[model samples]
Target chain A: MLRRIFALMLKEFLALLKDKRSRFVLIIPPLVQLMVFGYAATFDLKHVTYAVFNEDKGSISRDMIAAFHGSPSFQEMPQIERNEQIAVMLDRKTVQMIIHVGPRFTADMLSGRPAPIQIMVDGRNSNTALLIVNYAQDIVNRFNNDWVAGNGGAPPAHIVTRAWFNPNLESRWFFLPGIVGLLTLLVTILVTALSVAREREQGTFDQLLVTPLHPAEILIGKALPGFLIGIGEASLIVMVTVFWFKVPLLGSLLTLYTGVLLFLLSAVGIGLMISSLAVTQQQGMLGAFFFMVPAIILSGFATPIRNMPALVQDLTLLNPMRYFLVVLRGVFLEGTPFHLLIPQFWPLAVIGVVTLAIAGWLFRHRLY
Target chain B: MNNAQMRLLGLIRKEFLQIVRDPSSIAIAFLMPVVLLLLFGYGVSLDSEHVPLGLVVEQPDADTASFTASFGNSRYFSSVPFRNTPEAVDAMMAGRINAVIVLRQDFARRLRQTDGAPIQLVVNGVDANTARIVEGYVTGAWGKWLEHTALQQGQTLNTPVEIVNRVWYNEELESRNFLVPGLIAVIMTLIGALLTAMVMAREWERGTMEALMVTPLAMREVILGKLIPYFILGMGGLALSVAMALWLFHVPLRGSVWLLFATSALFLLTALGMGLLISTVARSQFIAGQLAIITTFLPAFLLSGFIFDINSMPPFVQAITHVIAARYYVAILQTIFLVGNEWSVILPNALALVLLATLFLGLTRLKARKRLE
Candidate 1:
């Protein structure tokens, strides 16, 4: 039975690897996506187009606008003459922020009075808009401190901000670990979901069932190829991320691979269950996609899980991607020890065992 | 009825029959919308709240206690006290805390001598966006603390400059206000492109395409037959999603629903055409499905300004997003839902949608010729 399952697994590999498109599907997409999404998934605001409406025309206002120009974050657009131009710039999205200096700007500042400078941010993308406002705030705060220090007054509160793990806070470092989990789920689920359904559609399942192989053997045969491909795909993405993308991998390789294999088992098991329930390849594919979309969304890949409603957060415990994301991020970013990651592993293990047992039961039931 | 019209009606009827027989497509068309709507509307949020923090105060004093109390009292942070920086760092590494606030031993003396008391904030920047948000929240908390302390001291240190920050369109700054509207484009893209791509490919995989090709039906009839059902399904999805956004999620529908429907129809045309084009290009089910996902779904999710800011992206990538149909749809959705019928915003995005719809449908019509290659 073992030998027969091995032979069946070999045949599955041959069919998958023999097709050039499948080979490309397994390799090229992950690498291409890694490069494309790596650069695209940035939260770091760089070279934000900004326009200045400095009505003051004082040396101080010019000096303030010069501060924005000196900073790398803002690219000063052509100065807007009227308030309406600021509105037009925002409406056309030509500028993300407009620094509007009122007519009394420098007069009040030199006379020790409160100068109200309006920073009109196009809040279409509120997150970015908020960050741009923060950047502008930092510049203004520096100018205020300079004014105070020159006048021999004490600074308000000194905030010494340091970001641990990712000092520069590069978003690529965060997303790379996540891609390992996401791409693994995508590949493993697609491979396994397409496996049994493909055989049944091609009229090969019956011939294989007529062999001396047990239902358990067929299940193993169907699952091993996807599990192996998932790991292989995961490793390639990991190498690209660690080497090509230069994301630091602080955890031991053994721990990362162990976590990946366990995650793959659960992903493959879910795929097998999807395949067993599907009557055709199309059904299998759609079912896999149906499961995948929600899984990724709820996994906290792009959004924080704690931000979710409590009931939905509870529901995420059942998702393997959710566990794997924590493990991958922990291992890659935090160098979380093997023992520390045991909590994440157990849920995946439980999910794997339950899904595989169910899949096996369904295969036996179908055969009978 | 005319003979041609009768044949087209029969074709559409057959398509619907096929849809009913295959539970997967209908299940996906209907079930996906509800599942995704709930997940996106309720489960997914960019709002950073309830962030865990490790508060390490070395040689704590009354002033330090009062300062740390502000962090504990704030709704944004839940603080866990630690003895020193090492212990807090350990907690941060273990993922027990998102950030660490350290008040040095001389913090009280520095505050007493001058207003220049230094506090160190160490944030675990694994999630860059989360880290940035935490930093902002912590700063706001510190500023509030400073203000309270000044009030107690009877000293109002007036600043030379004050900023009146007004976030336009979204007053309360709810991330959902934008996210839910943007999600409409993603849903329409998935249902229109990814779902329709598979149906045509499944026909080829099942050898039904050959049978249909041998019939007297025109290619236009066959294409329309495939396009019409999914178009209706996509519309149904849009209506259900918009309703969920407005009623369930309580996201305000500020624009005209009829205008939204009209623009959605145009976007759906482009999405459906992209689907038909993929299915025709890749005859096999597996390749077609993969193609649809890589081409439509990923682009819609990533490049379409669904979540990430497109203007923040590199210029080359920004250029790439211009061709993605969902980009235009997302722009239209955001304007209609948030900005409410601003023609300056709506007109350009609408014109782009029209152009993209024409381009995709024209390409699909060309590729979907009757002759089998």
Candidate 2:
């Protein structure tokens, strides 16, 4: 029985890798995605194009404009001559923000009253707008510190921040492991989701049914390729994440591997369940995506689950990707211990077993 | 009817009948976009709110109480009190809290003696974006508390420069305002590419292509036959998504409706042309679907500035965004909806769409002629 399943698994592997297109699909796209998305997925804002509408011609205002010129987050657009240009530039999104330094003339500040600096920003992409605001605020705070220290008054109260897991707060460290789970799931689901459906479409399911493989054996045979492929794909991504991206692998290899194993089991189970229900490869493809998009969104991979509506948050409880994400980030960033990750591990195990059982039942019931 | 037009009509009818029989195409076009839009509009948010923060104040005093109350009153965090730093650290490691704030024993004494007191902030940096926001919120809260304390004591704080913010376009900065519009590009890509590409590839796989080639119909008729019905179907999908964005989600549409429709049609052609190009390359439905996903769909999601900022992206990746059709479409859609009919943004992106549509359709035509010969 084991030998028969092994032979079936070998055939499946060959079928996926033997084709030039399939081989290209397996290796090239994941790497391209990993690299492109790794760089593109950062929340840190830069090259924030803004036209400086400086109203003040004072020395202090000169220093402030100079400070704006130096910030790495900001890039100065060609100076706008009239106020109408601000509207036109912002409306066309040629510039994301416009810094309107009020015409304080340095009179308020040198005389001990606070001068107001108005920041006008295009809020189309609100998160980016917010980050830009924060950065601009930093520049103002630094300027205030210098002006006060030079003039002999004390600086205001400030908090000293020390980030625990990532000292520099590089977003790549946060998003890379999440992408490993995401792309690994994508490849795994596509591989298994199409396996049985391909056989059905090509009139090979009947041929397989008569080959003395029991229903359980057929299910295992169908699942092994996805499971093995998922593991191989995940390991390669994990390596690329650590070595290529330089994201630290803070936890034990034993803990990470345990997570990879359980995560792949659940992924394969979900894939097989989709395969069991699909009649054609197209249906399989569609079904995989139908499950995938919501899974990725709800998994707290890109956005935090806590931010989701309570009903939607409850809905995320059923998603295996959610559990795997915690394990991935925890192990990669937090160096979370084995026992600490057990809560995440058991849910994936539960989801894997339940899904596999459902797939088995669907296969038997769908069969004659 | 003329000979060529008659042949194309017959082929289009057949495609329509096939789509009617298969509900999956309709599902992909209309249903999937609704689900995705609902999720993006309602479920996902970048505005940090109600973050669980661990607060540990040793030897609590009036200063600590007021500071703690300041954090409690702020809308950003829901504070979880920990008895000590170790307890807070344990909670952070367990993922129960996102960050920890510790006020030492001499919290009040230091503030009176010195101008700036040190407040220790330990943030779980696993999610850097959230951590950054959390830090900002904490700083804002601390600053607010200090000003209040200084005012009550009849002392003016030395705040040299005050910041006054004015946010334009999306004044509230709801992520939904832009995401819903950008989503139209993604939804249109799936409907345009998946519908035509897989259907064209299926004909080849099922031996219908050989039957069709044996007919007196020209290859031009065949390509047009494939393009027309799916084009209409994809347009219908876009109209439905636009309606949802405008009315259901209450996302304000600021541009001319006619302009929106015209540019969307151009973008749809670009997407459908991509479908034809993929069918030419991979003649199997399986490969066609995979290729469409890898080339068209994923680029639409990541590289299109749908969620990620293009300016923030590295130079090499930003250069690649030029080739992605959805990038231009997203620009056009966001500009039209959020900003207005700014032809400066629209015309260039529309021209890019035209060029890409022409390039893809020309490539498909060349490849199809070769394969047919």
Candidate 3:
């Protein structure tokens, strides 16, 4: 039985390799997707255009506008004449933020009165808009410090902020790690989902059944190659994310690999289950998509899982990608130890075991 | 009475039977987008709140303790106490906290000494956008607290500048407002392309194309027969999805219903034609599905500006997006659903879609096997 399983697995691998197109699909798309999505999926907003309505027309306001120009985050667009232009600029998405210094700015500051400047932000892209708002506030706060110190008064209630885990909070660092999980979902599920359907379509599935292989053996045989391919795809993405994108990987290599291995099992298992239900390649593709989209959206790749409502968060508990994303981020960015990763580790293990077992049972039951 | 019309009707009937028999396809077609919308709307949130934070207080004065208490009480942070900054950093790196707030030594003394003390804020910039928001929450809270403290101390530091964030169309900037509407376009494109590509390719693979060619059917009839059913199916899918978006997800429909349906139909024509083109080029269903997915899926998801902003993409990518049918549809959908049915916004995108659809349909011709041989 063991020898027969190995032979069947080898035959499946050979068949996959023989089809040049399938081989290409298995290998090339993952790399391409990694590169495209890695660069494109960034939430880090750069080159935010800001308009300054410097009513004060003083050195203080000019210096503040200069600070906005100095930062890579903000690009100072042409000055707006009327406040209405701010609305137009925002409407056109030409400027993400606008700063307005009041007309009595120099007089107010010289007379020991509070100097108020108005900052207007277009909140279309809320994440980027928030960034612009924060950066603007920082610049203003710095200006306040300089001005107050120059006037021979002490600044009150100094705030010291320390960002934990990811010091730079580079969106790429958080996103790239999650790419491992995303790529796993895309490749493994898609590849496995199509396997049985392709065989059925080509009339080879009957031939495979005629061989002296048990359905369990066939299930393992079908899943292992995809499992291996998923791992390879994940490793490639990890390399690009860590080295090329310069995302920090602070965790142990062993723990990361273990988590990846477990994650692939659940992904492949889900794919095999999708394959068992699909009668045709079209159904298979659709089935994979049915799983992939929800899995991705709910996995906390694009959004924070914590922000999810209670019911949705509970539903995400069933999604293997969620745990895998947690593991990937924990390992890559946080360098979480094995003990620290137990919550993530156990959920993945449970999902892998349950899904593979169900897949095996389905394979046995479905095959004639 | 033409043989072509009969043959085309027969093909469409056969396709519908296949779809009806395959209960999984129907389930997937209807359920996939509904489930995805619900998941995306409820499960995915770009707005950050209640993020875990670590706080380290160096000197325990009344002012320092009160300041720490203020941070702890804020709705944004679920504050966890740490021994020191290094310990907080370690905890943060261990994924225990989203951020850390450190009260420097002599913080109370500094508050008493001057109103211009320098405060340091360090944020983990792994997710740059989220990190920036985390910084905002911390600073916004701190600033408010500082104002109160200054008022108590009889020192007023007033800023003549205030920022008013006016979010138009979507007042709350709810991601759902954007994502739900975008899902309509994305889902429609996927179904039209994937379904047409498979069904059309299957006919060829089964040698039914040769049989159909022998009949008195015109090429136009054959194409129309295949196109109409999937078009109807695509529209049905769109209706179900839109209902889900409005009723279930609560994404408000601000535009004209007629315009939405009209633009969606036009967009479906382009997507269906693209799929037919793939089916014509690929002889096997497998290859057809692969071609369909590559052409339709990536463009619809990534290049279409559904999730990522196209303007932010590299210039070459932006240029390449002009040819993407989904780009036009996404703009149309966003405009209709979010910005309302303004003629100026709708016209250009509708024109682009119509042009692409005509081009794709015109390019996809019925090929004779005799010619190939």
| Best candidate, DockQ | 2
Candidate 3 Cα misplacement greater than 4 A, ranges: A50-62, A76-125, A162-165, A201-203, B1-7, B72-75, B81-94, B110-124, B218-220, B291-299, B320-324, B358-363, B366-373
Comparing 1 and 3 by lDDT, which wins? 1
Q: For residues B1-373, what per-residue lDDT tens digits would candidate 3 score against the true structure?
A: 6765567778789768878987655765677677766667666776677778777887777877767666755555678888788998877666567677777886767666645444556666555666777777776677677767778879786643444555566677777777777777778887778767776677788888877777666667777878888888888888898888889888777788889999989988998898888887666676676666556665677668776666566566677779888888877776677667656657888999999999888877644232222
Residue pairs in clash, model 2: none
Backbone clash pairs in model 3 (N, Cα, C under 3 Å; residues 3+ apart or in different chains), count: 38
Question: Where does candidate 1 chain A have its weakest 10-residue lDDT segment?
Answer: A359-368
Q: Report the lDDT tens digits of candidate 1 across residue range B226-309.
A: 889888878888788888889998877778989999998899888888888888877787777666656766678878877777
> Which candidate achieves the best TM-score against the true structure?
2
- Could you estimate the TM-score for every candidate? 0.95, 0.97, 0.90
Q: Compared with the real two-chain complex, what DockQ does model 3 have?
A: 0.45
lDDT of 2 by residue, B26-62 (tens): 8878788888888777887766678999999998988
The candidates' DockQ values read 0.61, 0.71, 0.45
Ranking by DockQ: 2, 1, 3
Report per-candidate TM-score of chain A alone.
0.94, 0.96, 0.92
- Score residue B131 of candidate 2 by CA lDDT: 89
